[model samples]
Target: MRIVVLAGGIGGARFLRGLKRAVPDADITVIGNTGDDIHLFGLKVCPDLDTVMYTLGGGIDEEQGWGRADETFHLKEELAAYGVGPDWFGLGDRDFATHIVRTQMLGAGFPLSAVTEALCDRWQPGVRLIPMTDDRVETHVAVTLPDSGSAAGSGERKAVHFQEYWVRLRASVPAEAVVPVGAEQAKPAPGVLEAIAEADVILFPPSNPVVSVGTILAVPGVREAIADAGVPVIGLSPIVGDAPVRGMADKVLAAVGVESTAQAVAEHYGSGLLDGWLVDTVDAGCVERVEAAGIRCRAVPLMMTDTDAAARMAREALTLAEEVRAV
Candidate 1:
């Protein structure tokens, strides 16, 4: 089996780990979201890509779901002591090596896709991981914040980096707009289209629909390529019942005017791109509504409480893909 998955950050990484276990013999290609990649301290940090690589390769901090396990923060502390810091985003000592290597390669004229491939060589993530684009595409969030000068009444609206909004502000403010900066001109990274074209099935994990999967889709040609791939393209809903399974997905969903509901998320993806959609058993009531939207819908337990749970979700997604292919 040849499978292609579009993934981002923690949720995507965990789901991919399960997917790998579910189909150990399958050929897997992970198209990682690069919109969350940030440049800090003159080093390139691909958070989602690193998360997937580390989780699959057994180096991830399982609890936090990002960064390396047994990680130390001496570098971060030293930087803070030196007064050169954005202390909110924690980049550990072990994780810093990844950024160093990536920055070095990028400085030497290697594209991000190539750099990712090189990094994956060490992790051996069990899948061919490609970034969505080699181009620099950063997700930006537009928010209204209290004016720095006038703190009494209303605030000013401004755009901030996704990391700033997520790591610093914690998405407390409503996101007026979610923009994947440079996605309009960004081409699919090397091997991305080929992987999509050859995929037996494609999956969208229960990652953030707005900043994660949504950012990848914002890239030119990627969405169209998936639609034309002729394989069953299915997705597991990040939203369950009335809220997200993890993260502040509801905040970003509202920005895009999509209600925080399983059925609504299915509609947001639309039948044009997605052939099958999976919602948790708690959202069984949405099955008919999702089906009415021309999507093959199923109610299953979508929580990734552990590897076993995630594997079950992967199996369910694959089964639905097979059903779609048959049709």
Candidate 2:
């Protein structure tokens, strides 16, 4: 099978590990979310791409599900001591090397797609990983700054980088708006359209919809390519029981005016783009609601407790894709 997956960070990376184990012989291509890409310490950091690469390359921190395993933070500490701030975002010493290399390659006039391919050369992440766009697209969140003892206290609203809202503020405040800056002008990466055109099955993993998968779709021509591909596009619910399985997906989902429910998410993607949707067993009652919207809905276990569990989810997703195809 020619499988194409739109992937975000931790959840997407972990699910890819499962997808690989589920269909070892399948040709897989990952279109990683670059909306999370940011420049820090004068080095370009592609968080989502690096997460998928590191996880699949067997160098991911298993416990955290991101960053390098056996990672140390001497470099971070040194930077902190020197008053180089933004200490909230932790970049380990080992992980710093990746940003340095990526920034160097990017400075050398290599497009992000080429830079990503070059980085994956060392990791050999199995699947062909490509950025959603070669051009810069950063996810920014509009949030209210914390109240200080002043008249303008809570009235202050500012747009911060997605990482700051996610890592620093920890999604404590509500997100008023989520914007994919530059996405409107960004063109799909070189292979993105071709991969979608050639895909037998396309998947939306249990990544954050608004910022991760949604951001990828924001790139010009990418969503249209998938919708017009004439193949099964299956998605597994990130919301198990009206709440996200991990992370603060609800916060961003609210920003987009989509309810954080399995059925709601399926509806958010809509029947046009998604042919099939999978919900956890606990959400079986909503299957009819999703199916009513013209999407083929199925209830199954959706948790990825381990690689084996993720493999089962992948198989179920593939099975659903087949069912959609049969229809």
Candidate 3:
């Protein structure tokens, strides 16, 4: 089977690992979220792409689910000692080399897609990984900053990079708005449309909807390509039991005015784009509600507690795809 997955960071990476295990011979193409990409220390950093590559390449830190395994931070420490700021975001020494090479190649006029392919050559992430867009697209969050001198209910509104809100602030404050800067003008990467056009099954993994999968869809022509592909487009809910299984997805979901519920997320994606939706067993009651919206809904175990559990989820997704195809 030809599979195309719209992936974010950790959740997406882990799910890809399971999908590979579930269907070893399937051809998988990963369209990684580049909205999370940022430039730090004058080096370009593609966090989501690197996460997918590292995890699949067997170099990911298993415990944290991101970054390099056996990673050290001597470079970070040195920068800190020199009073170089933004200490909140941790980039290990081993991980720094990747950014260096990517930035160098980019400076040499290589597009991100080519640079990513070159990087993957060393890691060999099993799947063909492509960025959502070659142009820059950074997810930014509009938040209310606390003002001690201001009135109790009022504060200054500021827009910060998604990483700052996610990593530094830990999504402590409510996100008033989430914007994918540059996405409006960004074109899909070279192979993104081709992969979707050729896909037998398309998947939306349990990644953050607003910033990850949603951001990829924000790129021009990408979402339309998938909707018109005439294949099964299935999604597993990241929100389980009215809360995210991992990460602060609820915070961003609220920004988009979507409720933090399995049914709500399925509805957010809508029946037009999604052929099937999977929610955890705890949310079985909402299957009818989702189906009522013209989406085929199935309640199943959605947790990726381990690779085995993730593989089961993958099997369920594929089975749902087959069911959609049969109909």
Clashing pairs in 2: none
Better of 1 and 3 by lDDT: 3
Winning candidate number (lDDT): 3
lDDT of 2 at 86: 84
CA lDDT of 138 in candidate 3?
A: 95
TM-scores of the candidates are 0.98, 0.99, 0.99
At residue 86, give the lDDT of candidate 3.
83
TM-score for predicted model 1 compared with the true structure:
0.98
* Residue 324 Cα positional deviation in candidate 2, in Å, after optimal superposition: 0.7
lDDT of 2 by residue, 1-327 (tens): 999999999999999999999999999999999998989999999999999999999999999988999999999999999999889988999999999999999899999999999999999999999999999899999999866776654568999999999999999989999999999999999999999999999999999999999999999899999999999999999999999999999999999999999999999999989999999999999999999999999999999999999999999999999998998
Query: What lDDT tens digits, residue by residue, belong to model 1 across residues 46-146?
Result: 99999999999999999999999999999999999999978889999999999999999999999999999999999999999999999989999999998
What residue runs in model 2 are displaced by over 4 Å at the alpha carbon? 150-153
Number of clashing pairs, model 2? Answer: 0
The window of 10 residues in a row where model 2 has the poorest summed lDDT is 146-155
